[model samples]
Target chain A: MDVTLLSTGIANVASVSAALARLGVRAAPSVDPETCRTADAVVLPGVGSFAAGMAALNRHGLGTALKARIEEGRPTLAICLGLQLLSESSDESAGTPGLGVLPVQTVRLDGAPRLPHFGWNRIESAATEGLVQGGSAYFAHTYCLRPSGRLEEAGWRVATSVEGAPFVAAVERGAVVAAQFHPELSSTYGRDLITRWLERARAQSAVDTTQGATPCR
Target chain B: MSMTRIIPCLDVRDGRVVKGIKFQGLRDAGDPVERAAAYESQGADELCLLDVSATPEGRGSALETVAKVRAVLGIPLTVGGGVRTLQDAERLLCAGADKVAVNTAALARPGLLTEIRDQLGAQCTIVAIDAARTAADPSRFEVVVRGGRDRTGKDAIEWAKEAVEAGAGEILATSWDRDGTGEGYDLALLEALSQAAPVPIIASGGAKTPEHMAAALRAGASAVLAASIFHDAETTVAAVKSDLVRLGFDMRLVSAPMLPSVSENSPLPS
Candidate 1:
């Protein structure tokens, strides 16, 4: 299946793209809004400041395109700062507007213990099946998303409430999946996750084909 | 709660694992990848590779070696020594390195931390602080830069806070005062930095026993990094973790599923 990964001017996108490649999935980097509309699935892979990431998406006019795709039931995945940018706003920079995909806000945990939490941490799975396996995944971030409601009930959000606030580590909404960790760098198990998602997408397409229904991909 | 970590430091010189005394008179311990795989098999929580050479050519070699290590190891790997930019970190990550540790570059340009972390994500960036206890004040240690070649007047505590604030995800603090001495960690420095900073700290330098590991953890270090003891064959990573587990520390047992091991048929470096 064709997987178009959103590249918002962030470096080292090949890591994620390569993981998808290993899964028998073709991963392409998309910096254009038009590309998001045609892909079977879209993955927003980014690392950096929320403000800068948003700026790149806005500059490329892919920000609006992403929301439209999500609304259309197309599977979308966000990673690291990409997940944080899905919120309404972020404390990383004042007045920075997120994609508003999830009803949440991003706050910097600079005072909690450090800025970027760099290491492997456990994520107790909220749902037995989804993008996140019921185990510890690697995470590296200072700011995290705090979703308002049961949106995170579909996935195990790693480490809720660092010091005082509920931080969202992973999120899943039907076909949409997002994570705060870099699964590409997460080793063999991590690579397996991408494969599972692709298989799920493929299986869903087969069912749609049999039923003469439109595939979500 | 986070699981306590046991990291084996692999000091590399000329593309092979080497051990030295006081940063001089080096001895070939084993191939870095072989040594790393052994430690991983023995329950090393993670692995750290520090390039000892101070040349541009050596830096390139370190990156290549990192790629080789990442290709074989399934667990996380942190690479240091001459990491100077976001591009360097990017290359290492693409090569399969889980994290990149920076020392002198961070001190020279504090903003590099944010740049690398922002570009590659913070969890993949580790700020390695080389420090030494100050004679004037035993309570404080000074941050040393350039592979412990120059001393920065920056206090260890202050630098730790700054590194964390600047977007460093973790700190691999090496105390020159206690390095290679097996005297135990500079607890005062560890406590001060741990209390002042908000992220996990990896205690390096002066660790000679399993007891030192427990003491550092009690002092708030989430992980303990020891080079000499492991490299010199005085102790094994498994032995240390077992000791820590026996001491009631929350150390991971490192099942074979969690760690990486080299195949028996693979070429073993002499």
Candidate 2:
């Protein structure tokens, strides 16, 4: 499978690229909006401030390209800061607008004993069909989106996890998957999840090719 | 609650894992890459690669070691040992490290933490505070730096809070009084710092048994770091995690059936 490691100019793409390589699928790193849009699968990975992440993406015009790609139901996987960047705004970067592909906003992880919510945490998925499953994944973030029913009502499958309070861990609709955790650092569960996602991304891309239909209307 | 982390620390000198007593008498354990793979198979939540090399030339190979380990391991990798400037931390992060632990450098100039945080993010910056109990005041802890050779005269607990405010996301607090003692972690130190520090506290030094780890966690450490026990193969990360689970602590558990075999370089199990 052709995978594009969407470079946010901050995250360690080597980890995700290495994870894919372990799965015997080589990933090409790209900051180009065109490659990010047309790749068979694109993994948007970041590990930093929401404002900085959005600024970098917008600088390269990949933010608009990603919204277009996800709107077209093209295979996309966003991780950590990448997931937060899909929201409308964030407490981490107040007044800084995100891509707004999803109707959500990121807020600081309150009520938790710690701030960053670092380390491996368990993800509990209610949707049986979604790529997110009940497994542990690596997380390093200060801000997160609480489980908002509005996201689910917006036609997205949201998985919740508890760090301080229940927060959205993973979200998916069609071939687009977003997680507030780093699957690449999740070991076996992550490898399995990536492999499964790759399989689905391949199939969905194939079906979309034949259907000649746009996604997300 | 955030998951309890079992971190296996590698003190690498000249690209090889080394065993030492209180950071002295270094002896080779194995290749950093090989040791990382073993730790991964043992379910280590994260791997800490510390460059214990004293010479400038020796530090060069430490980055090479991190790159080699990153080639095989999928867990979170935190690299440290002699991060003197923001450039040092940046070099390590650019060399495939997920997190950079700074100690002496952060002490010398607290702004270094802010610089790393601003450029690389707070999650990437960790302050590894080596604290030795002050002899004059038994209740007070003094910060030690330059690989525990110099006394900073700064309060460890206060520094932890300041470091966090300065942009350190985590504190890897080690007790000089208990380092390499194997008597168990310094509970008082752990409790004081855990309560004082706003960020996650990684308890280090003097952990000998699985219960020692549990005791540290109970004392308030979000994660536990050990080198001698895991490096000497006295116990595996899996064993410690199993013990944590048996002690009524929830664990991620020994991974699924597909974790790559440590015996050889293998592709992801499909």
Candidate 3:
């Protein structure tokens, strides 16, 4: 599969790319808008400030391409800050706008003893089968989109976790999956999650090829 | 809130696993990559690789070691030792370390922590403080550096606050008085540091048992990091995690069915 991982210029990208390599996939990291827009599978992995991440994407013109890909229902997996970038806006940087693909506000996580909820935490999802299956995952973030039933009302499968407050862990709609947790860092559960997402991405790409090319499955 | 993190700290000297003075001569025990994979399999939430052999001039082997371990380690890995400059921290992060710890160097010149934050956010800057009980004041803990060989007059609590002001995200608090004494963690020290530092405090040294770890957590530690208990074959990360669970501490259980074992030749996650 032609997987283009949108690199937001963070340093710890090795683990994410290595995990992809283990699954018999070489996810080439790229900031080129065309490559990001046209890839069979696009992974948006990010860390650091939301403003910086969105700035980098906008600077490279990949943000618009990314929103276009998601608008077209392409297979794209967004992780951590990447997930936040798909929201409408964020409290971390109020002036900086998100892709608004998910129609949610990325607010500061409240009710937590610590600001940045680091370490491993349990994620509970009711979906029988999807990108997340209610497993323990690694999380490191100070801001998150609070669960207000708005995402579910919009017909998206949402996973929720508590770190002093209930928040949206992941949301999947069609082939567009975004995770607030770092599935790439969750060890076996993490590996299994990526494998499952890739399988879905691969199947989606094959279907696209079939539809685009006359019943050639 | 979040679950208590169980971290197994690997002491590396010149890129080899150094299990303190008493070497645990297991088969290929000196290899950092092997031990890291084993710990992840055993359910460690995170791994801290401290290069004990790193001098003022950082060794390139440390970076190589971090890169190799990160290739197999799925969880977060924090690297320390010989990180005297902001460049060293950047190089280590590029080599795949999720967080960089500064001890002696940060103590000498406090600006390095701020520089790391300015370049690469405070989320990656960790200040490791080695504190010992002073005869001058048992209630107070003094900062020790150079692997606890040199004692600086700075107070541990005061330094932690200062480091946090200079952009430190977390404090790796090690009790020099109880490092290897097997008594337990200095709950008083944990309490003091937790009071002083607003950020997450990772308790290190003197973790004799799971009960000791629980005590440290109850005393306000966000995570518990141990070395001899894990490296000496007395206990495994899995055992400690289970014990913590049984003792009523909320912890994320680990079971890696897809991760390949160190001895396995398989490249794919089954």
Candidate 4:
């Protein structure tokens, strides 16, 4: 499968691209929207602040391209800062406009233990979805994605949550999948998700080429 | 009412599976996916995979490992090491991990907990606090991160409450002063942490015996996790569960087919 790793000039883009390659995916770092559209899947891995990441995407004109690709039913994976950019906006750096792919907003974890939550965590699943095999994965972030509706129905929504409010950690709409955590950095289970995504992208590629239909719509 | 949990943690390095002594010399632990499955078979309540590496390049291997681990274990798996933003947590979850654990980052941005909790949901996020008692404050432990490389100087008890209020649904408090020592459970820290927060607490560090497990439970730990005991075959999952049951903790016994551990380089099972 042809997979384009969106190079927003974020940290560790090569890592993710390399992982996808192991899954038989033709991974390439693409800043051009046209190049992104040509691939079966797009992976956006970010490492900087939300505002800066968005600015980068905007500068490369990939923001509109990303939305268009998602609307077209192409699968996309957004990791770390990439995932935050999927939301409406965040207070982290201020004035950062998210892609608004999911109906959610970002905010600081008030009273949080510290600046960045760096360690392994457990994910308590509230429902059955492909994203959740069962337990938790690692996490690191001061801000999270808050979504209002059922994650599945919203097309764009948070995958998991803390307490009662759901954070848009991972979003899946048919073929479109994105997350707030760095799966490539997660360990074995995290790598599995990337492998599965490549498979999904391949499957979706077949459908996209044959039916010429937008699965997301 | 409280909830039941199972966790599986993997040793990581350069983004792959690695193990080592207490925050020091490290070694490989084979493929992460294989190790995770072994833990699941043993009925791990939850899983924590920590990247022992400090370099950014090595951190990349950690993300690759999570993507692999998430594919095999159908249970909750948390990923850590060098995470600094909400996007990190989201990416891990997207790759199939259920939650993200923050340490150094959370200490740097205390309000970040609330921000992440507010965005995700407090239940899905967790704060992994590594604490060590200081000579100046022998009675109090302080939160440390970077694999116990950096000290936050924040009081452990105070930080636990701050984490919960910030949206952390759970806390994995590891005692650095006692980690890998296996002398005994850090009951004083557990007791204090439990009192400070309403969320579930997983008592880590210095778990030496089944008796230590009981002591932790009595001290208000929601769960007890140990590496030496678990990895050395010193105790089996059934034995530990039995011990918990005998200690008055309710446990469900289930018998499922145990599958052979699959290699990381192998194709996924059907």
Candidate 5:
């Protein structure tokens, strides 16, 4: 299946591309809107600041394409900062607007022992199927998506957690999916999560074809 | 965090894995890619590649080695040595290194740390401090650079704090006095650094047995890094991880399913 790995110019895009290749899936790292909008699946992987990531997407004119994919219920996965960009706004890079796919705001993990919550943490998956439940995933970020009051209304679910503080680990609202941790770096559990997401994307594409809908290129 | 990490540090000189006693008497260990794959299969949580001879010529060879290793390895890879400028760090990152470690350069110009952090993000920046106990003042330690060849007269603990404030996400503190001595890690140094720095501290130097690793973890290190023991096959990553787990220290055990053999060629469940 064709997978478009969106380049925000802030993350380790090579690692994600390598991981996809190892999974026997074809992926292209691109900033072009057409490559992202027409792919069977799209992944927005990021590592740097929210402002820098958003600026790149805007510069490449990928913001509108990403919105179109989400609105059409196409399969997409965002990792780490990519996950943060899906929110409506972030306290980090103050005044930077996110993609607004998920109705939530990302904030710093204040009062924690450390600033950037580096290292692996167990993710208690809320979804029963197609998600690695109760497995640890690598996380390296200071800002996180806190439990939003509009979570239920927006059809958002907390896919995992570290302590009692719930962050949006993985959200499955229609075809949009995101993980706050680096699945590319999370060893086996990470590989499995990516594989499951790809399988779902492939299945979704097949269903679209059967419905006689012309897939966007 | 899930568990304490067991990182196998590969000292590469001229693109080959090498081992030495406290940065002296260098000996070839093995090929970088072969040894890296072996470590991954043996359950190493992560791998670190230090180009002991990071000359302009050696830098090209190191990047080639990094690409080869990255091709087969599924875990995180951190590359260090002679990373002087932002471009150097960018080159290594582009070559497939998950993180770039800066030492002498960071010590020479502290602002380089901020520049790398701002450009590459602090998560990708690691500050490796080679520190030796002070001769005149036994209670303190001094930061050494140039592969532990020169002493900077700077306090190790104080430098660690400064590096963190300057945007280093992690500190690889190598105890020069204990490195390759096989006595054990400098627990007192690790304890002090851990308390002083807010970021994760990776304790390096002087690892002989799994118990030594356990002691280092208990001493407040977020992770334990070893070279000689793992390179020489004196111990395996699994043994050390088992020891740490047995001691009740949280560790990510390399399960059978986590092995690299479970690649794309492997069958997937429907």
Candidate 6:
């Protein structure tokens, strides 16, 4: 499957691309809105501040195109800062607006032993289908998304946690899914997660083709 | 809880892996790609490639080696030595390095740390401090540069604190006196730096056994880095990890299937 990886200009795109290639999926790094809109799947991989990331997306004119794809129920995966960028705003860069795809806010992980929650931590998955529940993934960030609100009516659910403080580890609302961990650097479990996402993209493409929709470019 | 990382440092000069006794008497270890792949298969948590030459002519070859090693390895790769400017760090990152370690240049111009951090994020910026115990004052350690050939009078602990405040996310503290001696890590130095630096401290130099690693971790190091042990094949990454686990240190274990080999059922795409 061909996937368009949105480059926020601060992430390690090479590593993300290599991870996807290992899962048998072709990944092309692009900030072009048209390319992102035409792919079988779109991955928003990032590793920088919310302000810098959002500025890059706006500079490339990809802000609206990305939101439209997710709103249309297209397969999209946001990792780390990419996940934080989906929120309404973040404490990391005060007053900076996020993509606002998910109704959430990102804040510094207070009361933790350190600032950047660096290293591997076990993720207790809330759902079974979208991500591998009960597995550890590598994390390296100081801020995390506050837990989803009101379980029943909330559009998203908590996919994982580190410590008792629950954050949006993986969120699934329609075709929009995201993880607060670096799957590209999470070793075996990371590879498995990418494989699962690619399989879903392939399955979705098959369905679209059967319904006479244009295939992803 | 954060897992303790085991990093194998490959000192590369002229594009070849080299090991020396206290930064002298350099000898070839092996090809960078081959040794890096071998260590990865052995379950090394991370790999550090330090260009010993750190010269204009050698910088090109070091980046080429980094790209080649990155192509075959899946773990995080940190390239150090000769990273003086933001452009140098950018070039290494573009070549597939997850992080870049800066030492001499950062010390010369402290602002370089902040500059690199602003451009690349603190997570990608690591300050490598080479330190030696002061003869007059055994309690305090002095910073050394030029591969431990010169001493700068600045206290090691003070320098670490300054580097962290300057936006360095981690400190690679190498004990120059204990380096390559196989006498084990300088626990007193690790303890002082760990207490002084807010960011994670990677205890480097003079690691001989798993017990030594344990001692460093107990003394408050976030990770343990060694060169001679892994390069000389006196021990394996898996063996050291298992030993650490037995001693109750949190370590990431590589499952049997993850062991190095070309399998017919490999999950990698064709």
Note the Cα lDDT for every prediction shown: 0.73, 0.85, 0.83, 0.67, 0.81, 0.81
Task: Give fnat of each prediction, in order.
Answer: 0.34, 0.64, 0.50, 0.00, 0.38, 0.23
User: Mind giving the per-residue lDDT tens digits that candidate 2 earns over B1-270?
Assistant: 667999989888877777666666667777788778888888889999989888889878888887788888888999999899878877787677989999888887899999999988888999999998898998999998765778888999899988988989999999987887798998999999989888899999999999999999999999999988877767778888988999988777875433443453223222
Clashes of 4: 112
Candidate achieving higher TM-score, 2 or 4: 2
Docking class for candidate 6 = acceptable
lDDT of 4 by residue, A1-217 (tens): 5677787653445446545654556667779877766567788877656777778888998898887887777778877677778778888867667888766677865543433444344454454657544344545566776656644566543356452344545667666767665676454556677777677777877876798774554
Q: Write the per-residue lDDT of candidate 2 for residues A1-217, one digit (tens) a residue.
A: 7799877664577778878888888888889987877778999988778888988898898988899998887888898888999999999888899999879788889888887789888888877777888878888988998888789788889888898689989899888899998888888878888988999998987876798963454
Two-chain DockQ for each candidate model: 0.33, 0.68, 0.52, 0.04, 0.52, 0.47
By TM-score: ranked, best first: 2, 5, 6, 3, 1, 4
Give the 10-residue window scoring lowest on summed lDDT in candidate 6 chain A. A148-157
Worst 10 residues of 6 chain B by lDDT: B261-270
- By lDDT, the better pick of 1 and 2 is 2
lDDT by residue (tens digit), candidate 4, B23-132 = 66655545677777777666565678877677877766677777776655544566676768888776665565556688888888867777666555454577988889
Residue B151, candidate 3: Cα error in Å is 1.4
Looking only at chain A, give the TM-score of model 3 against the true structure: 0.94
TM accuracy, model 6 = 0.93
**In model 5, what are the clashing residue pairs, if there are any?**
A38-A217
Among all candidates shown, the one with the greatest DockQ: 2
On residues A14-110, what C-alpha lDDT tens digit does candidate 1 reach at each position? 5576567656677777788867854667888877678888988999999888878776656677778888887789888779889887776787754
Candidate 2 RMSD to the real structure? 4.0
lDDT of 1: 0.73
Tens-digit lDDT string for candidate 3 (A1-217) = 8578887675567768877876779979898998888788898877777888889899999988999988777888898888999999999887999998887899988888875678887888999876788888888878998886778887778988998879888899878889998887888888888888788888988887787851211
lDDT of 6 by residue, B109-221 (tens): 88999998877777788899999999899889999998787989999899899988988888899999889999999999999998887778889989999999999999988
Clash count of each predicted structure: 6, 0, 0, 112, 1, 0
lDDT of 5 at A151: 67
- What's the TM-score of every candidate structure? 0.82, 0.94, 0.92, 0.57, 0.93, 0.93
**Regions of model 6 farther than 4 Å from truth:** A150-152, A163-166, A173-175, A214-217, B257-270
Residue-level error in angstroms, candidate 2, position A176: 0.7
